[model samples]
Target: MEKERNITSMIAAGLLALAAVVGAPERALAADGAALLAANCLSCHSAQGGSISRVEGQRKTPEGWQMTITRMQEQHGAKVSAEDKRRLIKYLADTRGLAPAETAGWRYLLEHDNNRVETIDGRYRDMCARCHSGARFALQRRSEDEWKLLMHTHIGLNPTLEFHSLARDRQWFPLAVNEVAPALARDFALDARAWKAWQAAPRTALDGSWRIAGFLPGKGAFEGRMRASAAGEDRYELAIEGRYADGALLSGRGVATVYTGYEWRGSVDIDGVALRQVMAADARGERMHGRQHFADSRRMGGALSALREGAAPMVMAVMPAQLRRGETAELTVVGSGLAGAVSLGKGVRVLEVVSRSPDRVVVRARAEGRDGLNDVAVGSARGKGLLAVYGRVARVEVEPANAIARVGGPGDAQMQKVGVAYRAIGWAAGRDGKAGTADDLRLGYLPARWSIEAADEEAEKAHDADFVGHIGADGVFVPGDAGPNPARPKSLGNTGRVNVVATVEAAGATVEGRGKLDVAVPDFVQRALD
Candidate 1:
């Protein structure tokens, strides 16, 4: 409990740091946003666009700008008073906020604990996410040239980056400049019209009482009430009270600072536990949705939602969002005004409706042989909750197509072991005997057998056979030692790329899904808060 408290305190301190800093803005000469930036940033950063500076060409979220400003303050001794810093952050973020359309499909990546596997092309994940959280890249907007420049800076500063196992295995620099940079620019580029329209749009007001519901993994589902009142400009204080599915009472209070006029960042204490909240309000402010994570353990937590008092029936949550295809399971659907027939939508066969109430329902269901997101329905009202269907293992997909395992050495600095999981999904070949089409059924993850082997003769020569770690029966990857071995390539460091295979017998035939592994230096392994 003491340890938990300490973790909570650390989390609160980090999140509340900005709140506290901006709350007591120091007295300074009244100046507009541009003046504040000129005084604080224009010294080293050029105000206008040029070939030499990154600031003019780059666009970022408020959190991204905050990170950059904090780094500038700590590393380069950029001088700015608290007031000046606050103004500077606002100036930069307002001028550089992501266009709403640009953020449409990807906001969850920024505002919540999103576990839905992002289908990033294999090469980019190996090249980028291995070093930093994928959010680091997803949160920024840049031109092709800017993206290329960033890669050049990376290779220039960390020459080791190119020689790492992944880089050496592929044509890293050429692919990055030619394919990756262009892709990122095309996908995440700045749009002046979108930005201008968003700026001109009215912002939502998030004050007053609201009904709330959410899920806490392991602890189970919950329903609650929330009251939000003004704290400052674009900021609000939240008081939350709720009950878990097990009838355990829960409560919390926190102050939220809004960003992009929608993103909500809050530090709160729930039932003596510390947690940080990341949520987004819609344009109407009718609902605010996101997640909360335990302070100490980043991975622990659940989804959260808030609706205006007496709002229309909203399906707030559905537990076990994903169900195995062709397997029967009991699911709990939670929401307000859950009445009449509860539909699991299309692609799901409801065996029986076990029970129904205004706020909760239990039913037996078997998801059909389809792989995709399906919505849950109660009576005539639609829900925020989703039900996904994944069929049995017709094929196995080993995740992290490119994965890195580190030689976790002894003691505190030892790199952590990496785990690779195999997903067994059912896919059916369509009329042309080809796999890409609406007719292809997706069966989600299933039980499978896992193993590792050297991919080729070169891998064998590198002693990848010796370097490869043992995969558990449950498909966890355990690494070997951080070697200075004479058996491996000396200049390339002690690392090897192995092949991970997941096998399962389905439809009377053995099917397999393959993925690659990188056993490399500890430095490249990404840890939380890094």
Candidate 2:
């Protein structure tokens, strides 16, 4: 009967294998635990001759089968589902238990290697399992001295670890160093070479305004000029100044030293606070690594790179000669003392001189004042030699007449206001005397007629007796008050009169007079429609 059962089991296993290849093994077995086990396990272990054959025919306790199945699952990447595990265990325990010999071998192997070593998952096992699986020590790559210091720090934090045992700690440290040093040395060698190349290169000049992004504390933008100068091979000086994004003016200067690889050492000052930093470039040039030491001794590491090209001007400052008033004299003044010469020409005066490397002397006529046309001449100093000359006069015109009301009027929309606009027509002389005039004039009225009363007698008396006028957008003017206020009007009417007056002295001849009129508005006019 036993022989017949063995033959039958063999037949069943063979048929199951055929079913797996021909159709569906699970469908044919259909919850039949014995058939499932026979189909799955027969290819690797035969009933009477394989490694598991000795235990295949014998019966074993459920616990023994459970442990055996778990080992297979852990070590062999077996695909048995939870339900299959329970069924397989029940079948093995009931039909073919563990043999005495198999049990003895497994126990002997287990006892000989029972140190409770933890097994890591495949990923971590491949990365750091062999030397030290403890992540606290594995993740760090510090120098030998730093390692020692860190170990002592850990000992203080974890008093139960027996860190004072120098012999044990020392023994393990060398093993870790031996295992990790080669990889670290290889990394450092590559980095060192890169830093050396960066140090040998010339410092690049940053000219123009650059918008600095990715800064800390707060993201800020600034406009400024930058210059970089190399002070020998590895040292450099850098400077930048401009208004910050928040409108505060800023100026910064720093010095740096470059090393092989992309490593740089530098100290920068922002608003008087010094920050030291080490910089490095990654394998890709798109990024830069920075380690900064703050004033409080705290350190932070980050990345930086140029946000755009052509950021700031390379030059420091440029001063272009601009004519603010009278013609720009053609004389070219050279030398360190030329600045002083220019300073002497302030307040409507011009001094013509020859170009000199160190100083300038008046060569011909000293500029007295403007002629009738409000124009100045370019000539040589009285005794000095003649120099080259150029001249240009600035055209000054008054802004809109209404702009004055916006500056000086009351807040109420109903308050009546009036103002005049004028342009300087250059100096002129006439019957009244020498006086300035409104080359072009326009008058504007507010929404309502302004409150009218007698002129401030005391205020009028305080001024020069010869002049009694109200300061208008044009020059000061003299006029009689038009009776009472006009109703709220919208347009101005023309008044036939002159407004500007000037006093002048030329060649011992003194002249005082009023200026000719180009355009004029009556004293009371209504505001215009919007």
Candidate 3:
């Protein structure tokens, strides 16, 4: 069994999907896995059906079960080996996991979209989200009694639950037990038609070859093929090979397991760097979509979408996501099952087909004056808005308008350096011909002149721009080492609050876009799911 590290990746944890070798696989059966669970959890969970009463009433993702077992050991002194734990988690997830539909609206939580500002409803926001991530609870399903039990556990563990700011002003315990519990139960009920359908459906068979179209936000596009073969009962070993938009080789090896039929999770060491792959394979397993992440740096990574080799015609990505009008650039269309002539919509002309393959096609295309997103069509397959062509730059915007960069602790094991990557995006004014409006046409990433400024006088006084970090030519902000600059006031560390600024030269003028960056201390507590 693979080591289950504390991992949660971004929306794009590389791509790992296959022909799921599933037919009521023996490992998925609850009978044997129940025996393993009973060996470890029965000691305490014995209070209820002597083996699996509490667990039988609840359903969750693989990660959720992992956290439950981890917490069991932490708070209840339960003991289980890593191998047994892995088997148990897979068994529970397969037999009693949340259906893929049930996990909707909260996939961002699984993808570790930390920068997301969740718009949870007020009741859930105040009562649940204020204490922890709304997604943490959103991914779970339970009965009212189970939710009540959870509330009891919360209060038992943290006696001050009802005394916090959000709770202190009201009859917290009564409201939680009465209103909140029932609402959660009704909304996130354990009984769901989706779950039943999921179990009854044929599981995705994940073995054989798959072609991938993955995009790393700051890094551009990557196209590759992965071969998966059965390694263990429910686990499959993977071999990935591909290249980036620039033709740099992307290769890796790893293993993946499917949970609840469609949830795909694995880790691949690409070019020696380990990355976690978290994807949602469709019911048929013919397609998969998810994020690939830089393992240790939870904040860094990209998204991935894949198609099983020999499957239906599907266009995965169009390189140079966007282009400028009246200009010709060599474009790459990456996808599978592609055949016939390549088309770049009405405004763009495919001047030449430099190279062609089922998975990739390089074409020299020229954009006419018309400006808008264009569909890249390969015969019958079409990738909607895979490529955008714009006439002129109307505005420049910075991605991830707000971000946090952790101060490097140098040699400290717990405090690693965090870097911030900034990209300046160009936009073409739409039919209204005005920037900053809702109709702006995004013109893809623009080469920018990156800089930083103190957000305020207080920051300026601290020489923030100099001490916090330096924005390099590539627009990457590399922070200084951790703390105690003896030459500075109060011997402070390299921490600051500042604004990230980028300038784009468009139509003989410089348009500026800005974002916020906080250079701060490292996060000490790391959880499996953030």
Candidate 4:
């Protein structure tokens, strides 16, 4: 029993020692977290109400603390590392879990942390720094709605940010306006009084000359005469001249109302382009802050900040027209900001141009030439055999004539024409040397006259009867008297002469003779011989 009691005491002491060791770390961790919070977060936040008194009772979840730390790094230039961020979040979540009373303040600070501004100028700088300067923002006195619309318009045109990003940024915008606009309004109120004094005191001073030098975000710069007016405080008018990049000379007249401290609101019409803008000087009055709006389809409005500088006069001119061939006509080119010149075509030529104004010119092109043919060759010109005008030509027409021949007896002859239309006669031949065979059978043009002779091939050769003849209108040959009968007659002795054979061919068809002929000698010849 004594041994067992001793063992139990040792076990209890061991358990107590382990508990002390584990408890020591928790205490150390809490102490370490307190130290970190004192070193970093206390500067901007406090347990009691102070600079950021709204968040004094606020508690945050671990995630909320992480998000807050990231916002600080982005907006306020805080440099907390990943490990430190984790530790900081753990400490905040353990020490001050979210409480109902602190919810509104905590949410407001977290949402608006990026927009918090310690100074009026800082607010202006943050709001307009992306596209313009603080000076440009300061020159405008638009209401909150107008400011929101301007920002929305810019966000629409800029594709870099998404809708969600714009929505997030827009939530913080009101906070910025609240911080900076009050200061601007106070400054403008004082400027109005000074402007009134300047206008009342101004007299006997020559107006300053303003000559246009160039343009800025929202307004044009010029150097010419600026005359003070007695109608209102710091009221003035200016006549300025300058040149555009295209060599066109521009002249403008403007009226301005000055607010004290070098701030001015004005509208001007240069050439035909109208512009409105606001300008203000910094506290030191060394530079101007302004916003300009141009009368264009885009209705572009932006900020402008520049130092005062001397101006000079220059001139610019309109560019000539650039013409190019397009299909069957010429293309007339007109640039966005420039006027277009006149052009002419094949049947048209520019006669004259009447100029009513620099921007408005009337051009006249008269038709002077015949309609041009579709196909034109540079060195040589040819046309279709058939008549055609400005259109495609058709195939050539052909009417080939048929072939014809004649056949007849010794003293009389007949003719006939045959075979295919739109065709020519080719070759013709005859046979010889047998009783029933053809001889002296020369083929020729059916002559104006025809006569039959002996069937001797030699005789036909001597007569040279193979000549070409054209088909007559009646489609027949009218054989005249035979050219002096052949010297020898064809003899058949007792059988007497039987018949004369003739053949005709045309294209691919042939016609042959098949009739007989008979001759009777007079008895007077026999009596004369007796």
How far residue 372's Cα lies from its native spot in candidate 4, in Å, is 62
- Model 1 TM: 0.61
How much lDDT does each candidate structure score?
Answer: 0.67, 0.35, 0.80, 0.35
lDDT of 1 by residue, 69-170 (tens): 877887789877887676666657766777656566666566544434465656568888776656678778887888999889888868888788778887
Using lDDT as the yardstick, the better of models 3 and 4 is 3
What is the Å distance of residue 267 in model 2 from its true position?
1.2
Report the error of model 4 at residue 96, Å. Answer: 45
State TM-scores per candidate.
Answer: 0.61, 0.24, 0.89, 0.21
Residue 20 of model 2, lDDT score:
68
- The true-versus-predicted C-alpha distance at residue 164 of model 1, in Å, is 14
lDDT of 1 at 11: 38
Model 4 lowest lDDT segment of ten: 386-395
Span of 10 residues, lowest total lDDT, candidate 2: 442-451
Give the candidate number with the greatest TM-score. Answer: 3
Candidate 4 displacement at residue 306 in angstroms: 8.8
lDDT of candidate 2? 0.35
Worst 10 residues of 1 by lDDT: 23-32
- List per-candidate RMSD values in Å: 10.3, 37.4, 7.1, 47.5
Question: Taking the tens digit of each residue's C-alpha lDDT, what string does model 2 give over 34-152?
Answer: 56565445554556641234343233334445655675666566667887786676555434432222232232111111112344444334323443333323222334444344345
